[model samples]
Target: MKPLALTFLSASIIALTACGGGDDNAENLTTEQVLSLARNTNSANQNYPDSATNELLMKTPEAVTYYLGDGVLRWSTETQIPLYFVSIDGANPPQTLIDGVAQLESRLGDIFTDFKLLTWDVQQYRDTNASDENMGNDTFDKAFFMAQNNLSEGGMILSIDSGYYDKQYSNNAQNMCANSSIAPFSGALQILWDKTGYTYSKENLIWTNMGNNHGCKWNTQTVMHELAHGMGMYQHFEPQFGSWSDGAFDVLATLYHNAPGTKWADLQVSTL
Candidate 1:
């Protein structure tokens, strides 16, 4: 593995502090400064640090319950869902990827009624029409696969691969940490993970290597994030008074970072 990049670590800290609301100095910043900071922390950059603090936050009873409750975004009708992990063009999804899904399922499950993961196994789909240079084909192929299978209940098709496409796969300039179809309620949802740097697998698909420290363990969070989008949680582009102040820590942001006090359940009305 390459030596932990200190520059990446610094960049993540700057981005998170600017929008995560963890910094005490955030209150002193001007609106212009905050907007500028928000723009900087946009989805384009997926290298945000996943610190230990974030993990602790997720483990808290309130945080787990928040996601398990009816408030968080999800397919309202389907409580038990099957998430299919796909490997495009013969690309193999590591065991860590499956482990990440299992971890997510465990996190959302409880003694009482809770979110259940029906399928965690990876299914291979060969996109013969896909080109190494064109990422759009991957998107098309994923949709094609979903259509062929008639996936309607709930869940998402998550593809993990190392493609020869640019980091920016969509109109947004975001790195290919992951992207989804943003289907909510009763539509097809797909998520793609570009394993170009092997960054995700190295961190077991959960955490990022920030020097000697573990940055954001977004593998599970990324799964939940994409699933949340599929469930109808829209990205917060502007600063909301009671909700997120920026795109960095939107409804899904609270899941990835250490924000225990945020009333995420109250942010959006539950479709359930």
Candidate 2:
């Protein structure tokens, strides 16, 4: 991956330094203040796992619980999971994507009393010269850009863009709708939507595939699947309802049945 742009890093340092005293006095800061500093600093450094920096910035138990734990990082449902909708290179997010998120928010609200999914902001990035040869890099570029601009602090970024063809799945690009990291790294997560994939629609908030004859199509379930990854559901398990031949079982269903606790990583049980 390319290094985060130097100018962005410089600007981030300047912006964060303005927030409070430097790292030497971080212990005196409140949990929220320290979280803000750590998040911005991690974003500027491209979200790589940095135990040393995390230890330095996160002094409070609340901050440590929110950003670090025994296993993969998971979002605490006690606070709202901010979702930032991003359109890259002028490719507007599809209506389906918007509706799907609303549906997710509703379902999650019903599932957890304190957990809320908030539509924090809608943003646009003008990467007019982005190339398909490195689509994953491009996705991270948009993520880092949003992070540096302070638009996605301690949030999940969902970016919609056209012309993304994952080379690893080149033969089935049309069937691949979207992708996301399995969990938050450095207190943030990212999701990339491929505008060229299967057409999606919703009826009664249940997403259905309306395009493509092969592979799984993009739908609300797909969003949930990818978002499950963002929420730290990493492993794929056997389908509960139907055979994989029909693309019936999804990560979301598995998560729904297995997630009985507040911690998402707890879903990694022997049942799956």
lDDT of 2 by residue, 1-272 (tens): 32111111112211211111001211233334323322332223344356545563344222221222222223444445555443323344466556556655554453322222323222222232433321322333434554455543334545432223333434554433344431211112222111121111000011111222223245555554444444433322223111111111223332343322223334332111
Task: Indicate the TM-score of model 2.
Answer: 0.41
User: Once model 2 is optimally superposed onto the true structure by TM-score, how far is the C-alpha of residue 269 displaced, in angstroms?
Assistant: 11
- CA error at residue 203 for candidate 2, angstroms: 35
lDDT of 1 by residue, 90-185 (tens): 344455455545643444442112222223212222233543222332243424444555544324444443211232232221222333342111
The candidate scoring highest on lDDT is 2
TM-score of every model versus the real structure: 0.34, 0.41
The list of candidate 2 runs beyond 4 A from truth reads 1-73, 88-93, 110-134, 137-144, 162-164, 182-217, 240-272
RMSD of 2: 17.2
Model 2 residue 52 CA deviation (Å) reads 17
RMSD of each: 17.6, 17.2
The deviation in Å at residue 63 for candidate 2 is 15
